[model samples]
Target: MLKNVVAVVLEEVHPFELGVACEIFGLDRSDDGLPVYDFALASARPGPLRTHAGFSVDVPYGAERIAEADLVIAAATGIQDGFPAPLIEALRAAVERGARVLSICSGTFLLGAAGLLDGRRCTTHWRHSERLAARFPLTTVEPDVLYVDEDPVITAAGTAAGIDACLHLVRKVQGPEVARGIARRMVVAPHRDGGQAQFVARPLPAEDGDSLGGLLEWLRHHLDQELTVDQLAARAHMSPRTFARRFQQETGTTPHRWLTGQRVLLAQRLLEGTGEPVDAVAARCGFGNAATLRHHFGRWLGTTPQAYRRAFGGVGQPAGR
Candidate 1:
């Protein structure tokens, strides 16, 4: 249903965020049997648009192009405080007509300006989350999540998360086969749940001296094994209390929480790349059983293992492979 797509740009747009939309929707992949969107770039004020990266892009279409789009993406721009009235109206019209709108990073500000985010759950980059919330008091800004999909408006956090939001839209509308095919071509993960946390600007303080990095790597390799705080602490050569404190300081989450997150990520990869049974995938990811895996999957990804595989399983792999 999302056949036509348009990226609405404003001056001083971030090239990478705009490129995210273009890469996912604008590229011609018909040779792969993937849908080729009727994609175009439109500017709120047509002509040469400056990018934050010191370059300018010549967008040929004007705001009117958005009217014909099935999906409208507002690319991140430096100028978010005020949006052109025509652009805002076009966005409102597009949404009113049942077209979905997406915002990458700071682009949520424009949606806020358009009053589209009012009383809706949305998010922007963690760095700008507070400002967005402050400016749009009516909207609920969830700062930690990578993205938020509230029907007509999908807002993604900084940079790469835009890919997650875009692929999610594809998966929801076209099915996982198309999304996975595009993701395979893009060489990126097809689906990172919107609930995943944004990596903080300072993930680990430099003073930590990379002491836990090796341990973390070891834990990843041993995810199938039953791990506990004591074992992890022993592996890190610290008291359990010290390890717990240090882990939180460095990772912004507890050891158990981080391990569970890693396991969930492993389960996701297994589900997408293989035709393994739900129980096998669960065991491989340390969930012990299919029921347990299902519980975690529902809590973390808002979907079941079977459903996820059906949506994103490898193209040629057997259902029971």
Candidate 2:
């Protein structure tokens, strides 16, 4: 249903964020049997637009192109005190006509300026979250999530997270198969829950000899096995309490939370890449049963195992192929 997409470019846009929209929607993947969006780049000012990275891009379209878009994307732009009135009106008009709008990082500000984010839950990069909340007091700003999708609108946290938000829209409209295929071609993860925390409190320092890098890798490979905190503690040669504290300190999440995330990720991959039955995928991912898998998948992905596969299965084939 989301056939046409237009990325609205403004002066001083970040190249990476703009590229995220282009990479996900603008590319022609018809040869892979994926949907090819009628994608275009539109600018309010038109002509050459400067990027934050000391380069400029020639955008050939203008605001008129947005009128036909089923979805509109506002790429991250350099921080400015004001936005163009015509651009803001165009965004408001697009939403008025039932077109979805998405923003990456600071681009959420443009949505705010257009009055689209008013009374809606949204987010931006953590560094700019405070400013965004202060400026748009009517909007509920969630600062620490990868992205926020309040339907009709989606906002991503930072640079890489834009990929997550874009792929999310693809999955929502087209199907999980289309989203996964696009992610595969992009060499990125097919899905990252919008509710996942954006960042850890501290970076894992290289000199910290008490690192859990190897242990984490082992856990990823053995997701089907039962992993208790006590067992993991003994493997790390530390007491249970000590291990728990260390994991929280280093990863900014509890061991259970981290392990559950990994399991869910594995389940997603298996569901998308194979035609295995729900019960088998559940047991393979340590959920033990189809019911248990459904519970966790619903909690994390807002969909059931069967539904996920229905949306994303086929090995390399596109949905309905």
Candidate 3:
């Protein structure tokens, strides 16, 4: 049912967050057998736009484009004269017309300014979470989540989390199959649950690179095999305690939590891409059985494996969150 998407590019916009919308909705991947959404970049004024990086962009469309959009995404733009009035009105109008709205990073502040976030649960960059909550007393701010989907309103934390939000929109609008297809082309994980913590504190040191990257790849490929914390430590050639500590430092989560997320992601793919029964998908994803898969899938995706399959297996089926 989603036919058009309007990305509201503001002055001082973060190119990466805007690029996330373009990557998911604007790209012409129809040649690869994915649905093509009508995506447009619009601004409050139709003219040269400035990026936060000190570059200029020419956007041809204006607020009028938001009128026709099925969805509107507000990309991060550096704070300007306390948010322009036209942008606020345009955003308010879009939501009033029943268009789904999404905000990335500081973009949520724009939503808050428009009074749209008054009674909603939303999230933004972790550093700004406290200020967002303090500024908008009516809004409940969740600091750690990568994104929050309060029905028609979605908000994402930071820049890369924009990808997770956009893919989730695809999953909600089309299905997991379409989302996975797009994600496959982009070479990123398709469905990281929005509820998962952003895991930001343990910043990877610049020189070390990601020590667990290789281990993660191996673990994903061998999901069917039993993987334990101690075994994973041995694979990393470190003591069990040391590996556990480092894993948390690097991934912002314990190994067990990370492994659970990977298993759930695999189960989601299997449910969407294969007609195999739930038990088979479970076994293949290392969930042991359908019941185990159901428990984890329900816990992670807020739906049963069968329901997810039914939704993403084909068109005209209801897409589950």
TM-score of each: 0.85, 0.89, 0.87
The digit string of per-residue lDDT tens for model 1 on 1-321 reads 799999988888999999999999999999999999999999777789889998999999998999999999988888455788889999999999999999999999988998999989999999998998989999999999889999989999999999999999998899777998999999998887687678643476567475588888888898999998998888888999999988877776789888888899899788888878888889999989999998988988788888777776778755542
RMSD each, Å: 3.1, 3.2, 3.3
Q: In model 1, which runs have C-alpha deviations exceeding 4 angstroms? A: 30-34, 175-189, 199-211, 273-275, 314-321
- Better candidate number, 1 or 3, judged by TM-score: 3
- Candidate order (TM-score): 2, 3, 1
Clashing pairs in 1: none
Q: What TM-score does candidate 3 reach?
A: 0.87
Range of the 10 consecutive residues with the lowest summed lDDT in candidate 3: 312-321
lDDT of each: 0.88, 0.88, 0.85
Model 1 global lDDT (CA atoms, 0 to 1): 0.88
Model 2 off-target regions past 4 Å?
Answer: 201-210, 249-252, 273-275, 315-321
Tell me which residue pairs clash in candidate 3: none
Give the lDDT of residue 119 in candidate 2: 89
Worst ten in a row by lDDT for model 2 = 312-321
For residue 274, give model 2's deviation from the true position in Å: 4.0
